[model samples]
Target chain A: MSRIEVGQRILQEDLEWAKANSLLFHKHRVGCVNMISSPGAGKTTILTETINALSHDMRIGVIEGDVETDLDASRIRRTGVPAVQINTKGGCHLSAAQVNGALGQLPLERLDLIFIENVGNLVCPSIFDLGEHAKAVVLSTPEGDDKSAKYPAIFARSAAMLINKADLLACGALDFDVEKAIGQARRLNANLEVFVISAKTGQGLDQWCQWLRRLVSQVKILGQA
Target chain B: MHEAAIAEALLKTILDVAGGQRGRPLAARISCGQFAAVNPEALCFAFDALAKGTRCEGMRLQVEIRPVEARCSACGRIWTIDDGYSRCPNCSSQQFSLLPEPPLLLESVDFEDKTDE
Candidate 1:
């Protein structure tokens, strides 16, 4: 009996597919951002607001992933940007293979930016790289500031974080400590950029859209990378 | 669960390695991060069931879950952490780099070699 040490990545195929997606994005000069959050964290609302704020100014595409419903994708389509709906059936996270298929369905060359709204999940989605240039996580104030401490994996990997639903805190309906959430997330990733936003009140949407434009320009207009 | 999906990938990897060999696979060793949230039981169950009609039927599995380790970027002290707590024990600094950890890795495989070596 011989013991062969075959050190391999168990999800090599999925990761390879993700890599291919990056190449596709690079060739098309598309700025793909993967958005992650828990359920009811205002991902769809923020997307609609952001798209409404920037669709006329920049070319954007959307890929919505959910366990069962296409409602989010439908909502994104109302913003007049092309959005694809991927129903995972029961999968907790969107896989690289699934994203690859979605990428094929989009108008890659015609768009300068793409947003993938991942299934509302904190854990599984953070682990999978969908070949996006950046990962943006949405954390609503009602979810509590300690969420970053609990789901550090996601916080650590995210490039930018949106503290959504800040209007709740303004009205004294919730007591989410924005500084505490930012501190916890920054502990994991020192360079994390944060935005306190409220999709309902139109607070902080300008800065969020501004960041999105800068990222889009970095990849499309300048980097071509 | 993604366990079934991950199991299929693991089985495919082991089979690819065992391909064209004179003997069948006997055991495999893998490692996962402590915070990867993968349930070993579900993975093993899926692997065993998928291996039922193959040469890898009843294969033994050795799974090692490694804790999260980090290095203080300031004081150059390395420490192991249980989870998301990233503060360095020595320097009490949050400015540190986490050790690179792949979520899942198949380290080694054991197989019977029927052919003359």
Candidate 2:
């Protein structure tokens, strides 16, 4: 009996699909951001606020992923941007294949930016690559700053982190240490960019929008190059 | 939770590589980093359940977990860390980059060749 050596990735098929999706985005010159967070971490709220803040200057589309409802998609549609809802039917996280199917329904040519609101999960979603140019994680102050330490995998892979619900901290309703959160995240990912914002109060959103604009412009430039 | 999906992927990968090779898979060696957050027990359970009808039915999944390694850009010191708030043990710099590597990988597969008989 002879033993054969096969050295490859177990998720090679998924990785290939993710790479193809990325190429599709590049071909359309659209910047895609995969947004992940724990349930009730204000992902939908922050997404809506960000859409309202930048929809005029930049054309935006959204792919909402949920376990059972299209409620988030409806909210995004109210803001006048195209939205596609993907109900996973109890699936823990959205997979690359699912995202590829959703991309077909989106008007890629008309959108400069597409935000994929991943399943409200901090763990499983972090493990999958959805072909997004950047991964932005929302961590609400109410969820506690220790989450960065608790879920290091997500923090390590995120390109940018939004410390949402800062207003709650301002009112002393929540005791989240923003400094410690940023420190922990940075320790895991030294290049991670941290932004403290409150979606309800429109606090610190301008900078977030600016970063989005820059990312879109950079993607456009890369497409040209 | 996602271990099922990972196991399915593992099965698909093994089958694709072992494609009509005339042998059943005996074992697979996989490597995951501390930051991968994979539960080995859960993955094995899922793999065993999913492999019921596949060629990997009784295959063994050997997982190797590697510690998270970082190299300080400032001091150029390399260190392995188990905690999330990893600082270079030598220079105590927070400004270090994680060693570039895939968090999870199927390093190799061992399959017995049945054609020899």
Candidate 3:
């Protein structure tokens, strides 16, 4: 009997494919962001708002991921941007392979930004790299402030955290401590950028839209560089 | 939940590496970081379920969960943190980065040659 030593990463193959996918985006000068959150974190709302807000200046495309329905994709399409729906049919998160397939369907040359709205899952989605240039997590105020502490993995990996449902702060229904949430998230990831916004009331949408525009421009510059 | 995906990847890697080998894989040793948030038992169970009727059937999964190591940016003190806390235990500073890099990795694979026996 002989023992063979195979020291390698298990997901190296998937990661390589993801890297290739990223290269494809870079070639097209497309800035992609993977947005992840829990089921009711208002990802669709924020994404639709961002698309509407940036539609005039930037061409946007979306790959909506969900377990069963294409409703989110429909919502995105209503905003006059190209939208593709990926129904996992029970899978928890969207894989890079799936996104690679979706990339073929998108009008890559026409899009300045592509937002791959990951399946509404904080844990599994964070684990899978979808070849996005940036990873963002949306946390609704109703979901409570302790989520960053409980789900540190996603918070740590995310480049940006969008605190949605900020208008609900006046309702007094939730004891959402914004400071604690940002503190815990910063502890896990010191470089994490936090944005407090409400998708429903559009309270802080302008800042979020401006940040996204800057990211798109930066990506374009980097591609040229 | 995501353990299923992780297990499938693990088995696929073992099979690909053990290509042309005349025996089923006996075991695989994987290294996971505390920051990875992988449940060892769930991963094993998923592996067992997915390995059924495959070449990797009955393979033992040896998961080595690596504790998160944090380095204090202020004092330069390094310590292993198993609790997923980012703060340095020595200086109580929140500014630190996890050490021993690569969050999750498959360190090695162990297989027995049944044809020789």
Candidate 4:
């Protein structure tokens, strides 16, 4: 018999279920950002800094995914921002279904940004699309420039790239060629936007903040009645 | 690592497509491009794990890994290699080469309906 090819239709019922909760979050004019990176690349630290800087201007919420710990959610709660944690119970990456479930618990209507901090891994998160407008991939300087070469998919799929730990450049053992990393990333995704900053020293954060502001503004404009 | 989640996605797709089919689907053909970074055996095992209690039970999954080879406009040579190689096989020219990313796609399912006779 002749073969028929079909497009990838993610299980509809499951997807619909995922959005059932998240759609309400968007109804409040919230924009979600899925931050993915390898473990110890400093995702939590970066997010903490972001919240600290923008909390006053923007109402932020967080959805933290980890193998087994409420530690991250606790950290976010310390800042007094509404945050929910989803312990995958050992899953490597967070699924859209899991995020959808977590969103129901969040106060989405009052939020300007919803950040989903994914389980720490470079591979699996690249494959699953969590229905976010943009995927931000974080790469630390000490993680090495070769990281992009080894894990191309993560960098390729990300709409924005954040090079964190810039302050460690002098003392750190790793020699990162930021330009080369950016070039390699562009080779894969020509439209990829690059941002180099240290979540610790706060170097180069203004540009990133500007980028976020622009994205939020665009979403607002698009959602206008 | 996320094989289980991926397996779930694959099974769901199979069940949805097989719903309108004639007899129970006996086999499914999947085309996985080299760039997809998916292991066929792992995928098969995952399929088995997730399909046990689903409509995809007892169905055979046949995965075909498509080669990532392209003709180099610079050297005019076509070569087959793994997903990692991006430079031209003959001239090592990145400019005039075409690289194919591995894409995962469900090709078709096989079944027969006796009631049509």
Candidate 5:
């Protein structure tokens, strides 16, 4: 009745660390978003766009994770927001403990939204919860429509899907069908909200921004009540 | 790639749970839920490498695989699935609350203390 275990104890320990970080996030009233996707999927671009759009209206902070560079965090800081970069050295994903350490350097009390840009790997980040309210998977148009079926684990655990680089869809280089891709994603997470946005062209980003606004407002209302 | 980090995390948890036992531990048993996409071979390799020169060295690592299962909260239907299927089978409802099928649990540990007996 028992099967061979694969990373059970390790994952459990990570889960405990994740829970501890979650408690800190809740206490600070920070709505954390763990942004995950394949490398070159424009995770940082989306983050920059998000920060630019909301920085005027709300206080925002970012935790940029990468294998060995402060490049992403440096870019985020250019947007005039407090951003911290976590160099995993060789880690494929960002754990809650790492986030916990980086959080100490940032002003969590001043931020309404905290975006944790996970190391660019769909497979690894999905396994470790970074104490986020929800995790988002960003797939560029060129990644193809089949991503949902191919990497269901990330798609399944994602609370929402951001179809980036919509402008590239016209070039026929990307076999992406926004509607069908959304349909398949819904099969895994029925409540998943799909957004087609071009962080470069500024297309379909308003909807995403609006959704974020709603989430922030809801958090505010809940806190007040 | 993160398997090494995971292994390190596991060792810390084991030591904490063991409560500073007076002797070396023999082995540890763990259960991984089906939803957790962990390659057993990679994990074993990582664990072996991480355990080197540590107190947990030469200990047998046992991993148990737990398949993903879902029971609908509204319809009360239970179904076992491969990987990404999260909906209910009978009522086709998405309202089911997930049971913690994936244990990711450190079930038990074996410690050796020839001197303490």
Candidate 6:
């Protein structure tokens, strides 16, 4: 028997879910950020610090994704903001459908910004579209500047990349080159916004927070219709 | 593996196509682009395991990792990217775009008709 040929997309439903999430967020006037990076890249710390800095001015919520445990959600809650924990059960990344469900658990009308802390993965997380207004990557100094080129998939897709843990570079012990890193990233994505920040020392967080404020305001204006 | 979900999606898509048709699925083809985070081997394994005891069982799966194609925004030259991206081979312009396409796709599915004896 001749083989029947049918052309289709396998992840069509998932893509639809992501697009729906994006539309829902836009309608609600909420800015969503998908934060992705390697494990131990201080994603939790960055979240806590960013929440502390901005929670006073705007309403912020979090969707924490991890392989296991609700520790990050607990930390985010400590800042007095709502956080929903998602356990992937060893999954390497967060799916848009999962975040769609988590979005329902938060106070959407009261929230201006929502951050989805993707499972600490530089690779798999980049492929999934959570329908965020912006996709940001947090690269710590120790993970090396070479990562951008090595993992072009993520750097290429990210709208912004934060070089985190700048505090470690103060001692001149780590041989990470900040300029080289940005330069490498630019080769793949010239418009990519680069921020050299330390969540521990609060070095470049002002600019980071400013970017968020801008994104939130833009969403506000767009959602006014 | 991270491909399990993707594989599951593949299975579901196939079932949707095979619903009304009277046939046992024979094979399926997938194209995994360079930008996709999927590992072809892992995807195949996951699909095989998930398809067991299903109508799509014993379906041959072919996953090909397509080379990345980038276009020079200035010179309008498009070429396949063999390795890490840096500059255009023709113009050396860093201003280029990785031709936007889906990172992964189930390109096609092959089904066989069952004949009444």
Give per-residue CA lDDT, model 2, range B1-117, as digits (tens).
888899998888888877857777788888887776789999999999999988889898899988987888889998887775667788777788888655578877787766554
Local accuracy of candidate 1 as per-residue lDDT tens digits, A1-225: 898877788999989999999999889888999999999999999989988889788889999999997789999988899999999998989998999999889999899899999999998898788999999999999899999778877887889999998988868877688888888888777789999999988999999999998898888765532
State model 6's lDDT.
0.89
Instruction: Provide the overall lDDT of each model, using Cα atoms, as 2-decimal numbers.
Output: 0.87, 0.89, 0.86, 0.77, 0.79, 0.89
Error of 4 at B54 (Å): 5.9
List ranges where model 4 is wrong by over 4 Å.
Answer: A1-26, B16-24, B32-36, B53-58, B65-104, B112-117
Query: What's the TM for model 1?
Result: 0.92
Put down candidate 4 lDDT per residue, B4-85, tens digits, no spaces. 7667777888778877765776678877655555777888888887788776777788887787655666677876644443
TM-score computed on alpha carbons, candidate 5: 0.87
Worst 10 residues of 3 chain A by lDDT: A1-10
Give lDDT tens digits, candidate 5, residues B71-111.
67779897775655456779888665445556567777777
Candidate 1: what lDDT? 0.87
TM per model? 0.92, 0.95, 0.94, 0.82, 0.87, 0.96
lDDT of 3 at A89: 85
Pick the winner on DockQ between candidates 1 and 5: 1
lDDT of 3 by residue, A111-208 (tens): 99999999988889988888898899999999999888788778878889999999999989999999989988887777898999998888888988
Better of 1 and 3 by TM-score: 3
Tens-digit per-residue lDDT, A174-201, candidate 5: 6678888887777666678889999998
Off by over 4 Å in 3: B99-103, B113-117
- Candidates 2 and 3, the one with greater DockQ: 2
Whole-model lDDT for model 2 versus the true structure? 0.89
Q: Each predicted complex: what DockQ?
A: 0.63, 0.68, 0.60, 0.31, 0.31, 0.64
Lowest lDDT sum, 10 consecutive residues, model 1 chain A, at A216-225
The per-residue C-alpha lDDT of model 3 at residue A13 equals 69
